[model samples]
Target: MKTTLVLAMTADGKIADVTKSPPTFGSDRDYAHMVEQILLADVVLVGSGTLLDGNESSEVREPDRALIQARIDRGQTPQPPQIICSRSGKIDPQLPFFSQPIERWLLTTKKGSLDWIERASFGRVLVCETADGSDIDWQAVKVKLAELGVENICFLGGSELAASLFAADFIDELWLTICPFIYGGSAAPSPVSGVGFTSDLAPRLRLLSVDRVEQELFLHYQVEKKSEDIPPT
Candidate 1:
């Protein structure tokens, strides 16, 4: 399956205010555009934090949810199958999201020791392999998602997952929204990705388009590994 990683950051490159939370610390337009792209996606790979914090079908508003619902009504489940990438299956069992009328898949490395909550039957528990050939076993993840019939995966990643994907070269494209704001706290959280920094001294991105909405500026970049980006792993 092809993956598109979507993110919203500030002009100074900050995703959170260093607190690991949101407002996305940006402009309204950034949020709007990000939400719009998410609605169009066939599969929304949710980050564990987003799920644990109680996001529901209604959280994604008009036009977006409306567009998604139209597909659901047309015999195409519009909720886009929330595939939660959880390291450990510790989400609240009775969370309204689990009961929401949508297809949910929880991809975890373990079939965690949660006995009170029976999630095995509610959704698919994907077990990810830890290794692959000299290559980074992209197959394990791809094959499993393909088995679930996922074609386009829109990754709603937190920092850690975003870093891992970028390092693994698992991301095909990136749609980043750079909000116009400078969070100058020495410890302010960055809105930018972490992968491109470690492997290669420099990250490469092709400028796609730039849009200004309200008080924010949205910049889109395509991330790809170049000859110089490959590290001596």
Candidate 2:
């Protein structure tokens, strides 16, 4: 599946403030842009941190008539399913996310899926782990997503998840909205957070387009991948 990492970061490259509070910096235009991207996706992917911190439903709120009609014409459900990635699967069942109208799915490890399996909170619970059992095997994840008919995925992240996908070379594109503010603390988190990559091994990108609206700048990039890195059909 083609995966796009969509994020809004501050001018100083922080997605969140030092306290890691919910993001409220993106402009109205940025929000519209996000909705547009989400509409193009077959499913939306998010890290558990985003669900816990944002405390918001993944549904497209207040979609315009045209957007709603477009999905109907495409024979897609009005709302896309949201698949949350959590290695621990320890989210509180009472979060507003559970009550949302959209279909909910969970991607976790064997041990992590036990509680969710019993609670029956998620419509589908997928257990995929690495050989060492340290993290999700993203290579396997790609195959599973394809098997489930997920052609396009919109990844709304909370840093760590973005880092993992990028490191694994599974991210195909990026839509980054650079906000006007600057949250310049060391504790502040950027779009991709984890152990930093070395220059030689870092993923490369080709600039696709840029749009400036007021103080915010929307940038699009295509991630360059080696032929060998791409998985076979």
lDDT scores for all predictions? 0.64, 0.88
lDDT of 2 by residue, 1-233 (tens): 79998889999999889998888999989988898898889999999999999776557876565886798799888888899999998899999999888889999998788898977679899888998776899998888889998999999997899889988899999999999998999999888888979987888888889999999999999998844343343
Best-fitting candidate, scored by TM-score: 2
TM-score of each prediction: 0.77, 0.94
**Residue 37 displacement in candidate 1 (angstroms):** 1.5
lDDT by residue (153-226, candidate 1, tens digit) is 88877766676676676777788776667766656655444434754444566667887777666666666565
Which of the numbered candidates is closest to the native, going by highest lDDT? 2
TM-score result, candidate 1: 0.77
The per-prediction CA RMSD against the true structure, in angstroms, equals 4.8, 3.5
